[model samples]
Target: MNKWIRKSAVVLISVLTFGLITPTQLITNVNAENPSERDTVEGARLGSYGQEASYFNEAEVDKDKFIEDLVKQAEMQSYQKFGTRIKPVIENEFREIVMPNIEKALQEIANQFPTEDLLNLAITESPGKGQSEKIFNIKNNNTNTDVLRFHVRRDNPPQAGYWFNFHYHTYHDGFQSHHELGSIYWDKNTPPKWMS
Candidate 1:
C-alpha cells in the first residue's frame, strides 16, 4: 500500500510539473536527436551563451593549422600586392628572401599567443591596389584590431633604382617601428605603380 501511494505521488508530481524535471531516458533521447542543441545549452550553462561551445573548448584546436593558413594567406596577399607587372620580376627573389622572414614572424606570433587566441586571428583579404604600402594585416576578429601589418614600400635610394622594402609592424610597438623582413630590387627603370 505504501509503495502504491509513493508511485501515485510521483506520477502526480510529474504530470503537474509537465516534465520540467524530465526522466534520464527522455533527456538522453532528446540529446541524441539534437546534439547541437545540447551543445548550445551546455555553452549557455558555461557562460558562453551566444558563441559555439566547441570554440570555447581549447582541446578542439588544430594547433599549427592556424599558422599554416595565415602563411598561405600572407603569400597570396604579397603576390596580390606585387600584381601582374611586378610579380614576374621579383617573384623568385621574394620567395627566396622575403618569405622565410614572414614565416618566422608568423611562427613568432603563434608562439606568443595561446592557441585559443590564435583562433580569433584572420588575414585581411584586399591588398592595396595602387601605390599603397599595404600587403595584408593579421587582425583579431573579436576586437577588429590589427595585430600585425605586412607592407612593402618602394624605396628609391638616390641612384639605386627601385627597391621593394618588405617589412612588418606589430601592435606591441604601436605599429611605428618597421621590423625589416628583407627587400627585392626592381630595376633602375622605375617599376610600374603597384598592382598596375
Candidate 2:
C-alpha cells in the first residue's frame, strides 16, 4: 500500500507539474522566471511547465540520454552545413565548449544519485573513439519546428527553427553512444533549449 501510494503520488505530481493541472491555473501559478521547460510531458518546452519535469524525480534517476543525443546532433549538423571548412572550428568547439561542460553536468548528477554508469559510457563512446562520422537526426517536439544548429563557414546562416539542445539528456550519453559510423535518426519527444 505504501509503495502504491508513493507511485501514485509521483504520477500525480508529474501531471500537476506539467500544465495538465489546468491552463488557467498554470498561467496563474507558474512564473516566467522558471527555466528549462519540462520535456517528459506533452507541450513541454524550455522556460515553462510541461511533461518533462512532471515525471522527473531527482530521486527516481538521472540518465541524461536526451541531452547526449542533442549535443552530438548539434556537432554533426554544424559540420554538415559547413562541410570541411567549418568542421575544424566546430570540432574544436566540441572539445573546448561541449565536452567540459557536459562532464561537469554529469558529475553533478552523479553526486546526487547512483546512476547506472550512463554518463561514463557517454563520454567514452562519444568523442571517445573519435568515430566522428556518426550523424544524429534530432528533431523537436513539434515536427514543424526542428532544433537544428548549422555553423556557416564564413558568412550568413539561416535564422529559423527552435534553437534545440544537442542531446535529449546530456552530451554523449550511454543509450545511443554505440552508434555505428553512419546515419542515425533520433526522434525527440521533448526538445532542449539551443545555446546561442
Candidate 3:
C-alpha cells in the first residue's frame, strides 16, 4: 500500500509539472513564430497594452495631421479676430509675415511636447472681440491650461501708425514675455474694434 501511494504521488507530480510546463512552452513557441506577439505580451506585462498602446501609436501616426489641423484652426481664428472690417486691410501682410512665424512657433511647441501630450492640445474657439488683443490660445485639454497664447496687440508708437503686433506668450516663461511674430501696420486711424 505504501509503495502504491508513493507511485501515485510521483505520477500526480509529473502530471502537474507537465501541465505547468506545456502551456509555457507552447506560448514560447507561438511567440517565437510571431515576434510581434512577444512584444505585445511584454508590453501587456509592462502595463502598455490596450488603450495606452493604441494612444501612443495613434499619436505618432497622426501627429502631422493634428498639427496641420491646428494650424488651419489658428488661421481661421486669426481671420475671425480681424473681422470683415480689418481683415482685408491686413490680410496680405498677416499671411506673408505673421502667419509663417506662427506656424514655426507652433511647430517648435509641438516638438517640445511628447506625442501623447501633443495629441491633447486644442485651439480655443473664440478669439476675443473688440480691443482685447487675443487671437487664439493653444491649450492642453488634459490639464485645462494654455500652452501658448497668440495675441495681436495694437501698438501706437507715437509717430508710427497703429501697428498690429503679432506675438505669442508661452507657458515656459510663465506667459510673461512677448515673442514677436512680426507686425502689420494699420493706418494712422485706429483700426476697427477687433471682430467688428
Candidate 4:
C-alpha cells in the first residue's frame, strides 16, 4: 500500500474510535499527503510528484495526525473561552471542511517549492490571550518573502466568535514591514494564496 494511504487509513480508524470525527463526515477519497481532488495536467507539467522531495520522503509524513492534533487543541481552546461544550456538528465541520483547506494549501506549497528547501523551514507557535498563530518560516536568503502562517482566533469586545485564516507574509527590508499576500477564508470566495 502507498504510504499516504496506509497512514490515512490508520488516522481515520483512530479518529473514528476516539470520536474525533463522525463516520459521515469522513473524507473518503482524499489522500492525507495530497488532498487535492482534481488531477490537472499542469500539475504533471510542473513535475509535481517527480521532484525529489527527499526530506519529505525520508520519513513518513503523517499529515492527518498533524491536522487531528490541531483540531483537538482548537477544541480545547474553544471550550475554555466560550464555556460551552463543543458539539459533534462543529467537529464534523472542521473535519469535513477546514482540514481539507489546510491540506490543500500544504500541497500547493509543496508543488511551488523544492522539497529539500521546504524541509529546512522552521515551525513556530505564538499563543496569546485571544489569538494564536502557527508560523512556518520559509527561510529566504534575499528577502523574507517565504513565511506562511495560519491563525486561529476568537474576536473580542462586541463580536464574540471564532475565525480561522491561512495566509502568506512577505517582509520588506526597506520598509521594515511585512505585507500580507492574501488570505484563505472558510468561505469559497478565493483559493489559498499560499498556492500562488
Off by over 4 Å in 2: 1-63, 98-143, 146-196
Predicted candidate 2 versus true structure: per-residue lDDT over 16-123, tens digit per residue: 777445544344334334444442232442211112444434453335543544345444444453345334434564556545554454345444434432222221
What overall lDDT goes with each candidate model? 0.77, 0.35, 0.78, 0.39
Error at 43, model 2, angstroms? 28
Per-residue CA lDDT of candidate 4, range 107-142, in tens?
A: 554455554344333333222332334333333333
Q: lDDT tens digits, residues 10-78, model 3?
A: 556558886543444444444455577667665443321112343445425355666676777789999
- Candidate 2 TM-score, true structure as reference: 0.24
> How big is the positional error of residue 49 in model 4, measured in Å on the Cα after superposition?
18
TM-score per prediction, in order, is 0.70, 0.24, 0.69, 0.34
Show model 1 residue runs off by greater than 4 Å. Answer: 1-57
| Ordering by TM-score | 1, 3, 4, 2
RMSD of 1: 15.8
Instruction: Point out the higher-scoring one by TM-score: 2 or 3.
Output: 3
Worst ten in a row by lDDT for model 3: 45-54
Q: Kindly list the per-residue Cα lDDT of model 1 for residues 1-196, writing each as its tens digit.
A: 8657655666666677786434443344444555777666654343221123344456655556556667777898888888899999999999999999999998897788787776677788789877899999888778989999999999999998989999999999999999999988889987888777
